[model samples]
Target: FAAVVGSVQDGGLPHAGCRCDNCQRAWADPAARAYVVSLALVDARGEQAAVYLIDATPDIKFQLEMVGEWLGPHPQRPQRINQPAAIFLTHAHMGHVAGLSQLSFESMAVQNLPVYGSVKLVGMLQETELWRPLVSQLDLLPIADEQTIVLAEGLSITPIGVPHRDEWGTGTYGFKIDGPAKSLFYMPDIDSLAQWAAAETVLNSVDVALVDAAFYDAGELRGRAAVRHASIHDTLAFWEKIDSQLVLTHFNHTNPLLNPAAPERAAVQAAGATLAETGMVFALD
Candidate 1:
């Protein structure tokens, strides 16, 4: 099963230094707050469950707590929660990689934890002096594009390269997780569907696709420079003919779909797409 630990975009619901209406609601109510986008894949077929985290978001601490049961207790320190078996990074974005700092000497202090990312992404981490110490504490593995890594008997993950903003020249990846009886595709960040030539084919091939829904429309940008994330309106239109379950996620603070009462939420539902919520679980079998 795959557990959604967080559903909001990088900065999360109550974005820093922003007093937007949505941020205001989240600030006023704890229940309304959300963390950055992340997913926990759990395989409990054996005596000991295998848990893998996709994207180590800035909200990793709380996100780990959400999956504490599956992680179980720490092996060395019984009082603390066990670290995930591995972490698969999607890109070099702040929300996707910031949580690594928490796992360093100052905090979790995880040892030899396998962290997978693109060759360039891993290189960037290994070359940075600030992260050198943390890098030594981890088993950094560079993954090739479209390479399938088998985690267990029937659980495997393939990191498919996707078009997105890559300032550091490190590519973005959308993970395709194949479980015993089902497959899921997770791409929390993408520049645009039109830019990806294989977008339709790949999305339709999966049982469920948790895609980027960062904004409702261009208008939400408020005349700012164009962003890389795809808008909800464009995503819905692109997946109109697809049969796979289109689960929208990675919402920005300004996105109207975040509001339960917003008509855009109903519109999305009417279009046969559902919104991604934290703690939502998807069965693999």
Candidate 2:
């Protein structure tokens, strides 16, 4: 069945042109990590469907409601959070999976929600208190660097290794999802573009590649986060060498590229990719 999945990236620099308190307390000291996010993967046809969320941003309530709205008016839809089918965890970052707590008894009480991540990922969640209690409640399925897991019929997801500073889980993963009609790659938070040079075959093979466009220009980040992932993830300069239909995401609050009419857009368009928008939708067939 064809699916419509969206990664809703909301909010911006908390203080606008300056870093917020949250960033000040954090390790990298980003301007702010206050983005209200949640992604929904909808299988509209099967009636029996699934929703795979890439990163569960802090805006949990709103995001979950949005996902339900995206499901549209399905008369026979299951009235349970289990209807979401599954969730593909990208990392253990505070903003990525922090919203899982919302699925507790006070909220949806989502039991047995399949969460796919690296084995190290599972341990990380187990080691942490917030995520540990719910591990048994929600079915947390751990996969390795190269493990391929089937989400649904005709839709298989394979995680590729990528470099990153791992605080909670293994580094990061670049997913290769194959559907019946087309294939897709989601590298939301990668380190640098060079990391894919050796695996160019896989990175360039997809019809649409959702990449990591965290920084618009070099030296934007306050410290390590900025200069760190340049070689493994896609930078504006990184795109110069990449040959694919790229849609960049996991943007830093500092990325001037988020502006639709900004010069960064022009440069991104010229680089053969587009910046990912909150509601933007794309198809492969």
Candidate whose lDDT is highest: 1
Q: Model 1 lDDT vs. the true structure?
A: 0.92
Kindly list the per-residue Cα lDDT of model 1 for residues 1-285, writing each as its tens digit.
998999999999899998898999999998889999999999988887878999999999999988888889998899999999999999999999999999999999999999999999999999999899999889999999999999999889999999998899999999999999999999999989889988988998999999999988887867534577887778888887677999999999888888889898898899899789998999998
Following a full C-alpha superposition, what root-mean-square deviation does model 2 have from the true structure?
5.5
User: Model 2, which residues run further than 4 Å from truth?
Assistant: 1-39, 69-83, 224-227, 231-243
lDDT of 2 at 264: 62
TM-score of model 1 vs. true structure: 0.98
Q: Which candidate's TM-score is highest?
A: 1
User: What shift in Å separates residue 152 of candidate 2 from its native position after superposition?
Assistant: 2.4
Q: In candidate 2, what are the lDDT values of residues 33-128, reduced to their tens digit?
A: 334433455555465545567666666655556567544443453664343677777777666777787877776677677878788887778777
